[model samples]
Target: MKSSTLSTLLVAKAIFEKTKSLVNSGDKYSCTAGIILLQDFVELVVLAVLDELDAGDQKSLESKSFDELLGELKKLKVPVVKSGTIKALNKQRVISKHYGQLSEPASIINYFSTAIVFTDALLEHVIGSKLQEIFLTDILKDSPSKDFLKEAIDVAGNGGYLQALALLRKAFFLSYEREYCIYSFRQQESSNGFFGLLGMLGGGRKAYPWTRNKAWIEANVKAPADYIQVDHEKLKTDCMEWGVSTVDVENFRRLTPKVVETEKGVWHLDYDTNFAANELSLENFNYCLDVVLDFLLKKQAFDDGHKWPKRVKSGPTPMIYIDKPIFERPSTTSAIVEYVKEDYYYTVDRVVSGFDVNEEFLYAHLYPKDKEFSLTLEDHIWGYLLAE
Candidate 1:
């Protein structure tokens, strides 16, 4: 268990105790405050479980309201708390906070009592012990890859084969990206001198052995700008060569085409029929899961470095301002624009000319330095700021 986890659990326990004390004080105001505190404690427990599970993005979760948080938890099927229970507690909280209604003393007591039970169950599920035993036992260890695998298996068990395959693909791509980054660093370091660096920059040199073949690069890379491309076929072959079972490799290969397809022209997941019954065997899916997990774990063991390099500030660059407001209502828009000058932020305004708008789709095109960039606004509240 990390120190942060420990501290969160401790705070949750303290809040629980305080809520109980307030309820016992026999005062209406104190009891209402206790109910609110209990709600806070439940939320804290939910967050702690999410962190423990290595679930989804913490920042996204932070932005969600209480109802939204519960909805997400339902999607994840977290066993800690039930949806009905959360809604009931939230209802009480709403009455106490917004309606200026004090819950009956017995109702408040019952709410607190239910909260205690819920928190206790949640702690046990997350840490495998009650609050008191948490410090006595070794801390829980979480693996994002393993968690993803579990989620995939759970989804598959519920007959959502396509969804499960999507999760498996996610796990595969995450590991692949990390492996590609490591290979990139190694290739960059091994190159000879300035020209060697130029070869890399100009995409003249092969980063990996598969890149030695031009046809393979075109088929696998798909895009000229994709430097860290991994060929799924090659990846399957490598896994088998590295001792992954043939059946597992074949099973994975069989599913790859269905997982992604070139529709019209653009490639994307074949979501429609991918989840149809009998498309994939349970045994093969399990085997493929094992194979991917084993391969990634083996690769991870070889390179124990962090997944990404720490970002460093680049040299200063010129700034360009927007001469006219991009949106009709500036307050309602959350869009931003920037230009890239060899890895530094530069600004662009109408003065740069070439501002084309497609009102039907809420998209705009900008031509800065003869390069075209497109921006769109959809459900995004904070539309976009392009720089990078």
Candidate 2:
């Protein structure tokens, strides 16, 4: 990342981490920096990531706060969009994960619409996997980031964008990306470390590629961020005690966003129309087999052909309820079948229980691993949500 691209004021992630410790433990300056630390991290990550995408794009990253960053990311070419993903938008994760505040219903909805799409793009480049195996939707279950995305989609797609944005304001007065960032990833666990230097990358390559190729050059990513965080003694002490485990000092990994296959009549299972996806046939597997006679009944779809949409139980207690299949592929993975959800994410490695989404997406981390923060499955779904 370029030094000229990021803001010095926003560059204090390490100091901010220290400030969070003080604030959490009742330090006077804690409250002031605590709330503001979120904004600082969001602002810096935006400036930093933008510079990484295109070095010359620094001016664009510097001038715009949150809105421009989304615009820049959205405008990326199809090549980058298809092969890449944009994570860390959850930079605003602090409010819920740190402050324990709930994001308003509407804010959660609107923010996610744009976010899911961006995350999808970034994941492709960074993880190099198909959408199905990426484990992104897995992360959404209890995650504030995932919740925000789903709620925003449900409200806006189900309601309207303006109303959703209004709800979004409850968390961020700006209701822009920066405010959202404050809610997601603002807390700094260390006074000095690689994450801090990433803060120092000041919008250069050091940070840019973090989103797409994070598995590639992570060792080099830490020094600057760590150096600065180490300078703050009190902040370091506070973080260690607050349940912000040492691993929290670096970054977290998450699943990529995906669009299910919805190609309207494009794909048809070799089963009977009596128990088809669009018909919502509540036929049991055996019943479906009976009517479909001699068919393999491998998959189903939506009227518009949304590949494996969520299966929500519809109608009354006595009604024959058919759910939208979470996945539209053969139960066994060894066979060569094109598990075509809307755009075709990677094939499932192993199905999670009987649920379609339980499968892991194909992800290969090319960047070097950072010693500071290593990602855990819990970070994505938060252990409790896994049960449901």
Candidate 3:
């Protein structure tokens, strides 16, 4: 592919992703912006395809309006399915942008669905690429959340909707529930760091140190926003706060299983009737994923260049000092899974139950070997620890 065409396709895909995030919002303004973005995506994708297929006509097409572009695509013998849907999307965009009209929040989803269907068909027919195959995860910062989202996509593609939803839920928690370094500054007894730099810039004046009372320091120094209490209720609140419609949240939660964070900052599954794995539909999975992408995208807007604190871990302690758990084990790893739900000190003895299976099996699933933060072996026993 030509570099210009490839670049245009990437930008178009990004716009498409942003549309998904925006249209999912409950806010009318966001929904209107989403409509405008969807129109831009359609135009860019068509432009990219035209540029690739017939570079000679690219300039003329670039000056064409949305309807004119469609007409030109048809004139070029390109297959343009769902023309009416595209037209309606353009009409909405025109009304919102040029005419200063607001789109109804409820109506945005119809446009989003139509656009996805049209884009999927267009891209597949023109370039053998499916719209679903394009992902926004590539543009996100490298984190475990991104990894989980990628894995969720793979799982969903393979018809593992439940597993995919679980992964997506994990991705949401990892993205939003973690601690961040906020602006923190206060007068200190010693001149150091920012104060020291300020002193050097004071025209040769020496740094002045001020000792303040504990109350003054406490009032002035900002603490890090750490370890959010995440649950199904918080997820709903977050979704609404991020502009996701209450209806969308309800739809998303209907398919998603329950998960709650413990006092120790570890998320544990709280299965209920909603854990109906067999009831998970592909359409619901897609919607849930879309809503989550919106949440993550919103966070990404402000999360750039911010330092997040790692999960806390316990120092090495003897296994013999820990108390053994007593629980019914339906499966080999069930007891260990239950044991690791809480914040336990370092020791396999704490998780060791009367019905405990081999430590290897327990460690492999509940706590993977590759995760450094999950590993807390003390006195030759696998121990539970918070993951980073």
Best by TM-score: 3
Off by over 4 Å in 1: 80-82, 135-388
Candidate 1 scores a C-alpha RMSD against the true structure in Å of 22.4
TM-score of 2: 0.21
- Backbone clashes in model 1, listed as residue pairs: 1-139, 320-347, 334-383
- lDDT (10s digit) by residue, model 1, range 80-107: 4545676698789988988888877777
Residue-level lDDT of model 2, residues 1-388, one tens digit each, is 1343323322543433443343444433334344344445444544445554563445655676465565665575423331211233344345556776544433333333333344334445433422222322331133333344334334644544433332222111111112111111123443144564443333222222233133322433342222111222432443344434332322110011101111321211122233233322221221211111111011111122346845495323221112212322323343322222232112222323433456432211111223214443221210001112
| Ranked candidates, highest lDDT first | 3, 1, 2
Worst 10 residues of 3 by lDDT: 203-212
Which ranking of candidates, highest TM-score first? 3, 1, 2
* Higher-TM-score candidate of 1 and 2: 1
lDDT at position 281, candidate 3? 72
lDDT of 3 by residue, 1-388 (tens): 5677678877886787678769888899999999999889988888887787774566677677888878877887877887987898888898999998999988888888877777777766776655444445334567787788778888988998877887777776555533211111233333345454443332112111231222334554342221122245655665566555556555655567644343334555543564564557778788788767656666676456477865487545433222343223423344442343233333233333223233322121233234435423222234342211
TM-score of candidate 1 against the unseen true structure: 0.34
lDDT against the true structure, per candidate, is 0.54, 0.31, 0.60
Q: After superposition, how far is residue 88 of candidate 3 from its true place, in Å?
A: 3.6
TM-score of each: 0.34, 0.21, 0.47
